[model samples]
Target: MKRQLVEELKSRMKLLQEREKSHTAELSHLEHKVKVLTEEASNRRALVDSLKRRLAVASREKSQQEAACLGLRQDLEKKSQRVEALQARVSASERSQSQLEQTATRQLEGLAQQSSLALDALQGRLTQQSSLALDALQGRLGLATKQLEQLTSFTKALASEVLVEVQEVRSELCRKRKRKRLEEVGDVGLKKSSVSRAQAVAASILNMTPTDLLHMLDTPPDTEEASTEDSRRDQEWLEQVMAILQQQIPAAGRLMEAVRVKMKERKVLTEELAALTAPVSEKA
Candidate 1:
C-alpha cells in the first residue's frame, strides 16, 4: 500500500506542472492585445488636434474679409455724398448762367438804343449848323450889294467934280489968248505986270488935275465908325458859334460819363456772377 500511495502523488505533480505552463502562455497573449489598443487611441487624438487648427485658420480669414468689405462700404458712402454736392453745384451754376445771359442781352439792347439816340442828337446839331451857315452866306451877299451901291454913288460924284474943273480951265485959257492977241496988235495999252498976273492964274488953273480931286472924294467920312461896325458884327458871330460849341461839349461829356458808368456796373455784375457760379471744391 505504501508503493501505491507514492505512484499517485507522482501523477498529481505532473498534471499540476502542465496546467501552470498553459496559464503562462495565455497571460503573454493578453498583454500583446492591450499594447495594440493603446497605439490606436494615440492616433485618433492627433487627428482631432489637426482638425481644430484648420478651423481656427478658416475663421481668421473670414474675419479679415468682413473688415475689408466694411471699409469699402464706408468709402462708397463718402463718394456718394461728394457726388451729390457736385450735382447741386452744377445745377446752381446753370441757373446763374441763364440769368446772366438774359441780363447781358437786355443791357446790350439798352446801350444800342442810347447810341442811336446820341447819333440822332448829333444829326440835329449838324442840321442846325448848316442852316446857320446858309443864313450867314445870305447876309454877306446883301452887304456886298450895299457896298456896290455906295461905290456907284462915289463914282458919280467924282465925275461931276471932273467936269466942273475942266469947264473952268477952258474959260481961263480963252481969256489968256484974247489978251495976248490984243497986246500983239497994239490996240490998247496993256501993262506988263497985269499980263504976268493973268498968265500965272491960267497956269494955276491948268495944274488943278482931275486925279487929285477924285482922291480927295474917295476918302471915307467916318473911318472909325466903319471899323467899329465890322468889329461888332464879328464879335456877334463869334459869340453865337461859341455858345453852340459850349452846349454840345457838355452834352458829349455827359454821354461819355453815362457810358462809363454803365460799363462799370456791367463789370461788377459779371464778377459777382462768376464768383457765385464757381465750384467750392473738386468732385470725387
Candidate 2:
C-alpha cells in the first residue's frame, strides 16, 4: 500500500508542473498586446495637436481680409462726392459766359445805330449846300438877262437919234445953199468949223471921235464964200459915213442875240445838273 501511494503522489506532482508552465506562457502574450496599444494612443494625440495650430493661423488671415474690404468702400464714397462738386462749378461758369455774350451783342447794336445816324446827317448837309449854290447861280443869270435887254433898247434909241441928226444936217446944208447969194463973207470959216462940235460930242459918247459925226449941225457957212463942188462932195461923204454907222447897229443887235442863245444853253446845262442831283437830295 505504501508503494502505491507514493506513485500516485509523484504523478500528481508532474501534472501540476505542466499546468504551471502553460499559464506562464499565456501571461507573456498579454503583456506584448498592452505595449502595442500604448504606442497607437500616443500617435493619435500628436496628430490632433498639429491640426489645432493650422486652424489658428486660418482665423487670423480671415480677419485681415475683412479690414481691407472696409477701407476700399470708404475711398469709393469720397471720390463720388468730389465728382459732384466739379459738376456744380461747371454749371456756374456756363451761366456767366452766356450773360457776357448777351451784353456784348447789345453794345455792338447801339454803335451801329449811332454810325448810321451820323452818316444820314452828313448827307443832309451836303444836299443843302448844293441847293444854296444852285439858287445863287440862278439869281446871277437873271440879273445878266435884264442888263442885256436894257442895253439892246438903248442901242435902238441911239440909232434913231443918229438918223434924225443926219436929216437935220442935210436940211441945214440946203438952206445955206439957198441963202448963199443973200449973205456975206463967213463961208470959209464955217466950213473949217463944221466937224468941231460933232467931234467933241462923239468923243464924249463913244470914247472916241467918229468920222460919221463930222457934218452934223455945223454953223451956217456964208453962202457967197462956200458954194463949190468940193463942199457938196464932202457933205455927201459925211452922209454916207452916217449911214454906215446906222448899219452897225443891226450888227450889234445880232451879236446880242447870239450871246442870248449861249446863255440859254448854259441855263439848260444848269437845269440838267440840278435834275441829276435831285433824287440824291430827296433821299437824304
Candidate 3:
C-alpha cells in the first residue's frame, strides 16, 4: 500500500510540472501579443495626429481662399459700378453731340437759303442792267455808223472834185503849150495871165473862185492820204471803243454766268441733301 501511494504521488508531480510548463509558454505568447498591440496603437495615434495637422492646414487654406474670393467679389462690384457710370456718361455725351450737330445743320441750311435768295435777286438786277446797257450801246453804235457813212461819202465827193479840177488845169496847160508851139503865137496876155482860163473854168464847175481853185491846185495831191489818215484815226477810235465795250460786256456776262452756275450748284446741293435725308425723313 505505501508503494502504491508513492507511485500515485510521482504521477501527480509529473502532471503538475507539465501543466506549469504549458502555462509559462502561454504567458510568453500573450506577452508577445501585447507588445504587437502596443506598437500598432502607437502607429495609429501618430496617423491620427498627422490627420489633425492636415485638417488644420486645409481649414486655414480654405479661409484664405474665402478671403481672396471676397476681395475679388468686392473688386468686381466696384468695377461694375464704374462701368455703369462710364456708360451713363457716354450716353449723356452722345445726346449733347447729337443736339449740337442738329443745331449746326439747321444754321447751315438757313444760311444757304439766305445766300441763294440774295444771289437770285442780284442776278435779276444784273440782267436788267445789262439789257438796258446793251440797248443804249446799240443805239450809240448805230448813230456812230451813220455819221461815219456820211463823212466817208463827203470825203469821196471832195476828193473827186479836186481830181477833176486838177485834170482840167493840166489839160488846159497842155493845150496852151501846143498852141504856142504849133501856131507860133506870142502874146503878152498869155504870159501875164498866171491864173489861166482853165482855172476859171474849173472854179466855175467846182462852184468856187479862181483864187480858191489856184490855192487848191497848190496843195499836194496827198490831201487824199491825209483825209484817209483822219478817217483811219476815227476808225481806230471806234475800234478802241468797241474793244472796251466787248471787254465790259464779257465781264458782265461772265459775272451773270458765274451767278447762274452758283445757283445750279446750289440746286444740285439741295437735291443731294434731299436725297441724303430721305430715309431719315421717312423713318421720322
Every candidate's CA RMSD: 38.3, 40.2, 33.2
What residue runs in model 2 are displaced by over 4 Å at the alpha carbon? 1-123, 181-284
Residue 113 Cα positional deviation in candidate 3, in Å, after optimal superposition: 11
Candidate 2 TM-score, true structure as reference = 0.24
lDDT of 1 at 275: 47
Rank by lDDT, descending? 3, 1, 2
Tell me model 3's lDDT, rounded to 2 decimals: 0.68
TM-score of 1: 0.24
Candidate with top lDDT is: 3
How does candidate 1 score on lDDT?
0.61
| Candidate 2 per-residue C-alpha lDDT over 143-216 given as tens digits, one digit per residue, 9 for 90 to 100 | 97677667656654554454344445544545544344223334445543554564677767975545434333
- Clashing residue pairs, candidate 1? none
Model 3 lDDT tens row, 1-284: 99999999999999999999999999999999999999999999999999999999999999999999999999999999999999999999999999999999999999999999999999999999999999999999999878766754564454345434434544444344344332232243454344377678899999999877865665457755855774565455444433433452335454344335434534654555555456446756
Local lDDT at 179 for model 1? 41
Query: What are the runs in model 1 whose C-alpha is more than 4 Å off?
Result: 1-119, 187-284
lDDT at 129, model 3? 99
Backbone clashes in model 1: 0
- Model 2, residue 244: what's the lDDT? 41
lDDT by residue (1-284, candidate 1, tens digit) is: 97888888878887877877777777777777777777777777777777788778878888888898888899899989999999999999999999999999999999999999999999999899989998999999899877766754553344334333433443344344344444453446667677556556655676754444433333345644754764564455434433433452334454344435434544654554444334322211
